[model samples]
Target: LLLFVYESDASPIDTFDLGPPNTDVTVHSAISTAELPNTTNTDLAHVMKLEQQPLTTCWPGRVLYLMASNFSDKQKWVACLEAAVKSIQRKDTIVRTGMFSKTLLELEGSRRLELNCSFALCKELVLLGADEGLFCVNLYHGTHAIITQLTGFKCVHQIVYISSLNLIILITGRERSVVTIDKRMIHSRIDQANSAAKEETNPIPHTVIEGIVGCTVMDASKCHGGSYMVVGMADRVLLMKYNSEMKSFCLRKILLTRGITL
Candidate 1:
């Protein structure tokens, strides 16, 4: 390892090679060096008396004595070096513990191959949307089932689930329109798929929320006695309200944004 010191502006001033011939032992406090009978470094002893603890990189072949400007600085250096050493000692264990992966499914051989998919999660249920359709996977029981096949969608770009209203909104990339589905429909399909113990199935019904087209991004929230949706378009933003009686979102207000949004 190479340790470097930098100026306040981050310009490298000095570097020490703490590898190979210079690094095989533990670092020790400067006060421990004062107790050594053969200690000849009066500077280190003096620094210890001034409340600045020093450290020695006591390499097997050579020793590099280092001192900090203050007690806090010394503690920081000691803590960092000790942490680095601990990290090196558990390098393999750390790699093994930190890395993980799981294969969900193979789509290459299936005709229902998803293209440009979007994903959303609600508790143990995972929602996946593609050009072909929307799918729900129950992680608890390993049930993968289709919620609905979105009609005329070239690709599903974004999927948002509003738990407050138990509704899901999907944005189509090519059509530039919004599709809404009930969360109850997803759960019902998962239940049916789990009982049948199958992978593929017919889709549930869905409603395409019309009028609002050229949608860039959309989000919904329920607050202050009502549920609202904020939909972004090429030149404007639509603030729509959810009408529970109609089971659809209705346009409420519009705000013009001359430029595109994030």
Candidate 2:
């Protein structure tokens, strides 16, 4: 496993381990180097050329976020957030068009076919709009829906996972606050509005937390079948506990000092 250590004024430091649990951590400095070439690129290029294709392709919009979901078999699927409408194109056809074909054609005929294929958007989405409000996308049964808007927050820092309750907790750096959204509620709303129109609606959030002040770095990890979260603020770290009844997290302990500032 890899461990990342971040300092307030310095670049992030990383350490890697390849041994058992008793192994001591071996720290390594970050390497600033060019990307290594993929071993399969040569084979891919040959196949593309044989199929009369182009070597490069581009997506339609600016990508805002990307995430991966792992399966039990260790396979992973990627989810992307783009500024505009998202679509998937066939790689074979994309190469044949030299990376610029908006439409495809049959080799033996004059018929034209569009290469745009619409897909369902990802479920656990957090879109930070220009207004600094978070717009969440909830997907269920192959349908996409929007949940509640998280306003009065700026610069969403990170999302922590709560595996026991299957919840996603969002932390904000601007407000030094945290909020939790009910995953089940989002799924239920999508099911209830399955056949309805695709208009946006505002639903109440599970919980909203505030009153904390400063820039904060939040981190979470699962251990011993439970989740523990740590929030590093100006001078100290705050420990929090996930409360299933409240559907939000509560601060359990606060380590305070007077020497920390943003």
Candidate 3:
């Protein structure tokens, strides 16, 4: 095997092939250069061209009993199975096409301890609730904006989108009390960012329900086409529903989990 390595520092070549007896000919440094592709670009190009190799390509008759005697053989079969499952799973995932293809946008700002995400009144908009504040992203235009008035919070526990009421209900707080902001006012501010947005805005009106306040909310979800929502706490599950005017969320019931002592 022959290996070719390009040297970066090129010294002047001193060769004695003159017409006279012993004349030395000196070559300039610009005569030779080390020209190679960037290491990162080469790696990314290699990764893009790579494809998964199936285990059955070598072993012909392992369809019935997929058994392996060694660890390396087991890993090959696992890789093949994972690749096959991913191919089948992508077909079941939902996709929403825009006016054009998916655009890649580079994010500018930063956030600490990202917690939850919820869809806005328009399906294309996404609300990202982090520990610092709430950030908005327009999926259609691929733009990001921060809701200035929605700051000064401990931690964002969960975010749920109530599409029927055009509201984004999110829970935030670490201990003592969990604040729930269920209102359409925040949605209008996000919508206004696209049409007519301004600075120095007032605080959005919201209510705080105490059913799952002290308990740590593990997860929050809203039923499809239903007026009810469920919040999974550390020990119990909280069930809530919107009022007739769709203004505030009232606790309907709580499903407590039985605890056992060791």
Candidate 4:
């Protein structure tokens, strides 16, 4: 099994290949756009473009998935994928240099961009306080844009994956309680904002995780099973699980360790 990860400016996408080793898995290869029309291999894969800009604070980008194309004629498609790669690389270079002056307010002001946030999944950017928030410029439209904001006025720490339910787990603090929101809600907010500019409304939907097990400024949260979320504090990690059988989150386990400290 081989896993390929791709990182844009913000989040990462990961994909895996499960096949016999060295058995000609060349169908999935990451190639640049300039390498098109030339044949070095037969198998062709999907092409992906970095959707977000790179962070300036030195945080490395997340690795996404392996290339997989839906087009016919894998070899020819590979050529197209190469072309996309070159285009993305060129665009990324320009975006990185341009992001310095493009703050969220400036982008929103000139473009009428709406902003929202959530914790359930990893966002391309987080909009902080009044001055510091995420901002993105429309290369295609030449407009400045800011994505949605999280429900609870807090900063997102880490996002965890729940394989059993196929849901993203979020960890946020500096505010009371943890919250989870569905990805669909984000789309709805964006659509609503676009349709109704004069309507004074709350854009993002929020579900708060109540009943504090413990508190810490810097901590990591993990989902175990059911509705339970385990939080790692200074000296211990508390497991908070939802007993669907009971319809409420409950503390299930507590592990103490020096290294496990969040």
Candidate 5:
């Protein structure tokens, strides 16, 4: 694919050739580096705080997702990575470039962000897991703003949206708990935060998995469109199944690696 990094759509800065597609399909499936298994391992302390800046968005700016309107489009998540890199690179250099934005959203103190996941149930909102807690950034009114900040979670590592179940899964860095939140509740909270009579609401509806003070959750994700969920921890990889009868997540099994010391 040809990637064009331009000041504006009318003016082009540079073009990058991404070479020939590996297959005729154009886009390839990939996995994140963190998901790969390795012998080496280290664990974080039980008590550690993270620092971060406010949430930000670059939807149509430097970072853009060229998604086909059709839901079945195979290139739904395939985007222009090289073009975005060049645009941001120019801005970081001596060149006074305005290819993108600095911060679409801002807040007090450093909002050290750990992980972020997007929610499309209602409006376009980004759920940011940070040192302070869980923060939601809304993309409406032509502004990216921190709508609400949910406390209690000292360090949140991952947040995943389960569309089929209409659930939001939160993984803590130290607690090793998977908290479940209803999508409707989040929508209500964000809506209330934007209204005249603002009130704080509990975003998490129930504790799917709890009281595991042993291991820390490293990462988590949903599969089969929320039918199943998986979490990686310091000690083991947990495979959780969604119990439709109970309407909660239940630990199906734990896969642990044995460490060999010579």
Candidate 6:
């Protein structure tokens, strides 16, 4: 048969005629465009001017650089691409677990800080112990301000909060003595100081822990919801228990270590 075909859609299929068959005729099927792989280069430099701040896109095996018409459009494109990357990375447990590296709040201070160490008393409050003095900072406040300062101690290294007795123990580095402050007294003084004048010369009243030489590490059971305390010195470890009668902590047992180091 003899076949006539038209490439344009303006002509109907019935307009073509099929004549008597001829043995010399040959027919071939068409190859689909979808079956062919894209071999064209997708480089942004070749597509547009290089000064447009193009963005690079990445996948498993293929990479493409996309260009935007303007700078604002480029920013939007970059933001969208970053969001997509974060969405995929979040599916990984290890990656999601370590993603919180952003800083939420920063400590602000007016004077020069000589901070040696710090301790978190609760979710909102943190105790900063320094050579200058001890400061109480509120973390959730708008300003993150140091609400109060307790003077009378220097070279403070470690701080412990005892909830049972409402006491705060301060351990000075290399000092043989420790300072104890009552939480009730601290709160009362804070209220008074807010309306009263600032006193720089007078120091706050605190109990002094004496007779312990070279006090290095001091931990209390109050830290663990107990009433006992353990103090590690240069040569010995003292086990002290709280005495409710006198409203103070007293030495209950002392283990001396002459040949062993604390």
TM-score versus the correct structure, for each prediction? 0.58, 0.40, 0.46, 0.39, 0.51, 0.54
Task: List where candidate 1 sits over 4 angstroms from the true fold.
Answer: 1-92, 95-124, 140-154, 194-199
Q: Supply candidate 3's per-residue lDDT for 210.
A: 60
Q: Estimate, for each residue in 1-262, the C-alpha lDDT of model 3 and write its tens digit.
A: 1112335435533322211111111212111112223334323222211122222234222111123445465556556545654554355333312313454334544523354544453566566666655655656664443333353444565676655665566667665244545556666655565455553234556666665555544334456655676666666777777676745667888778654111
> Each model's RMSD to truth, in Å?
13.6, 21.1, 20.7, 16.4, 17.3, 20.5
Order the candidates by TM-score, highest first: 1, 6, 5, 3, 2, 4
Query: What are the Cα lDDT values of the candidates?
Result: 0.63, 0.42, 0.47, 0.43, 0.51, 0.58
lDDT of 5 by residue, 1-262 (tens): 3335543566454432322111111222232235333312222111111111112332221211232334333233344443443455444444223323445555555543544443444456667676556777666633435456754555666667767787777766465467777777777766766674343445444564654443444334456555777666555676777888987767788788563111
Whole-structure CA lDDT of model 2 = 0.42
Kindly indicate the candidate among 3 and 4 with the higher lDDT: 3
RMSD of 1: 13.6
| 30 Cα displacement, candidate 6 (Å) | 50
Which pairs of residues collide in model 3? none
Query: What are the clash counts of all predictions, listed in order?
Result: 0, 2, 0, 28, 5, 2
User: In candidate 1, where is summed lDDT lowest over 10 consecutive residues?
Assistant: 46-55
Of the two candidates 2 and 5, the one with more favorable TM-score, higher being better, is 5
Error of 3 at 74 (Å): 22
TM-score of 2: 0.40
Give me the candidate number with maximum lDDT. Answer: 1
Q: Which stretches of candidate 4 lie over 4 Å from their true place?
A: 1-143, 150-152, 161-168, 197-205, 213-228, 245-248
Give a tens-digit lDDT track for model 1, residues 1-262: 3335643445444444333321343455566654545655654543231121112343234344566776677777777766765565465454334433355543444535565555546566666677665555555553243333323334777888888888778886576789877878767766766678666444766788878778888888887989988999888999999898998899999899998755
Q: State the lDDT of candidate 6 residue by residue for 1-262, as single tens digits.
A: 1122546556443321111111111111222234223423332222211111112223222123334555566666556545544454455445335444545345555655678778776676667787766776657764544356765667787888877777888887456477678876665665566557543323668987767667777877654554877888777888887777866678988888774334
**1 or 4, greater by lDDT:** 1
Error at 64, model 2, angstroms: 40
Name the lDDT of candidate 1.
0.63
Over 4 Å off, model 3: 1-115, 118-124, 140-154, 176-183, 191-201, 214-226, 258-262
Q: Which stretches of candidate 5 lie over 4 Å from their true place?
A: 1-102, 108-123, 141-146, 197-199, 202-204, 211-226, 259-262
